[model samples]
Target: MSDTNVNPQITDAVTQANVKVVGDAPAIAMGNLYQAAAKSTGILFQNATGTQQQGALAEASTNQGVMQIYAMDTAADAATQVKVAETGVADNLTGLLTVLESFKDKGNP
Candidate 1:
């Protein structure tokens, strides 16, 4: 038999301290959530940050903009695909309406 008196307040304080330690770095929680979601959905992502370069290449690269390149490239590619799809949709709808009108005229006669 033990005669140790346990303090509820002390135990609660210890538990809170452990939680605080675990919560100190938000990256730990974020990374765990990301991993869990990826496992459930079978998707993976990586952050792509690189070290700063020094020289003419870095200066030349800095003079231009990556955002502009990505935006223009994506817009150009998507616009061509959308334009072709829209033309096909328009032709299909016109043909269907013509067929429906002929059916209506035949039924009314």
Candidate 2:
């Protein structure tokens, strides 16, 4: 009978596959890490943008309130001026009536 021996081909193939996987592991891990970092940075920028918009809205609301107060103050001042002008007109009318009454009395006498 001839001696029989097992071929080492299958074992060699498995070893090469394992070596390839091990050699590529670092690159794969680094790629995954970079992806994660990009996602994190994107989230951070989105939050910052939201915060800025909120701040701008708050500022606009505050400015609107200030404008309303200014308008009210201006209206009050105008009302005061109108009241003063009406009082002056009433005083002038009264003085004119007194002078006309005196002139009529002197003419009748």
Candidate 3:
């Protein structure tokens, strides 16, 4: 207790203000912690969404590549059919046997 001449009312008001600040400290800290947690949760969801989208895009691209390969195979078969039709001879083991038979008949005649 100092022997100063400060008013009792003023001292009481200052003491109440300090107590109020101290009382609010825990609530302020908890609010900040909740805010940080919410932000971290939001970031985690955003990253998950991004990875899912990338995986979907990769799947789509792979499917397109497979479709292109199938299309190329069909196109090659069509070209071979056209060539076989124009030449009137198949290019297989049966075709080779037919040609050999024809040569054998010609040689015998």
Candidate 4:
């Protein structure tokens, strides 16, 4: 055979492939890091959303409780007013009966 060797060409091809892979390593690592950061940000957003929902629910519950208390107070006030009116009516009826009795006594005399 001729003295031309193919080993040098093979070595050069292998070396070039290795260099390309080594050069791309940083890019691959950066892409992976970016994906991880995005995932972390999504998790944080979800947590914040959950907290806000909880706060809204708590506020609604407190408002409902306050409304209930107000309704009870209103009902109690109405009941007190009715009781006072009934007492006044009863007093008036008693006075009228007493006056009628006095008129009857005078007529009998």
Candidate 5:
């Protein structure tokens, strides 16, 4: 007979999932939403800065259309600068990067 070992967590997860509807995380839906919003806002703003920069770069040589874009660009730039200067954000980002680098996909065959 051919030998193959199924991953234990996959089996356990299936069993537990079938037995239980959901976990504590799912039971508190609004709390999860607030948590997600709090956690993701920073990441989203980081990305949004890049997107806004690209958009501004695209419209660099344009005529004065609306002041809204200019105000947004200025605010975003100031916020990022403040975030960089405020606390241990650099160290936190470095730690996150290191953790990501350390993740080796052993499951990939």
Candidate 6:
């Protein structure tokens, strides 16, 4: 206990272990960097796929709404034609045209 001398073999072993760690540091660091980069790339791909799917859903919804609007317009036109046929006369615009003609005649005079 009084002699504070460390054995030469123990000192050499410790020194070799420290040197091994130092020599491997760059390889270990590079491996860690590559792993992190790969994980980030995977996450980016996942996000892109999710966005694409959402866009597809929105497009489909918009197309469905447009079709519904077209159908409604067609139904309205058909109903108007039926009414005109049943009445045997298309008088809906006649009154408006008469008023417009009067206004035109007044303006000309």
Which of the two, 2 or 6, has more lDDT? 2
Candidate 5 lDDT, 6-100, residue by residue in tens: 89999999989876765654768878898899889989999999999988977874635555556567877889989877767788899887877
Alpha-carbon RMSD to native, per candidate? 17.3, 15.0, 12.4, 14.9, 31.5, 10.6
Give candidate 6's whole-model lDDT: 0.91
Best by lDDT: 4
Query: Model 3, residue 2: what's the lDDT?
Result: 75
lDDT per residue, candidate 2, 1-109, as tens digits? 8987757998889999999999999999999999999999999999999999999999999999999887787877899999898789779889999988998899754
Model 5 per-residue lDDT at 56: 93
| Candidates in descending TM-score order | 6, 3, 2, 4, 5, 1
The count of backbone overlaps in candidate 2 is 0
lDDT of candidate 4 at residue 22, scale 0 to 100: 100
> How many pairs of residues in model 5 come into backbone collision?
0
- Of the candidates shown, which would achieve the greatest TM-score relative to the real structure? 6
Q: Give per-model TM-scores.
A: 0.23, 0.61, 0.63, 0.59, 0.23, 0.64
Q: Which runs in model 4 stand beyond 4 Å of their true positions?
A: 1-6, 74-109
**TM-score for predicted model 5 compared with the true structure:** 0.23
Q: What are the lDDT scores of the predictions, listed in order?
A: 0.77, 0.93, 0.92, 0.93, 0.79, 0.91
- RMSD value for candidate 3: 12.4
Q: Specify the poorest-scoring 10-residue window by lDDT in model 2.
A: 68-77
List candidate 3 segments past 4 Å from native. 1-3, 74-109
The sequence of per-residue lDDT tens digits that candidate 6 reaches over residues 1-109 is 4979899999999999999999999999999999999999999999999999999999999999999887787877899999879765457578778888998898764
Q: For model 5, which pairs clash?
A: none
Task: Report lDDT (Cα) of residue 30, candidate 2.
Answer: 100
C-alpha lDDT of residue 23 in model 6:
100
Tens digit of per-residue lDDT, candidate 1, span 1-109: 9999879999999999999888876978888999899886653222212223345568778667775676577777899999897789779899999988998899764
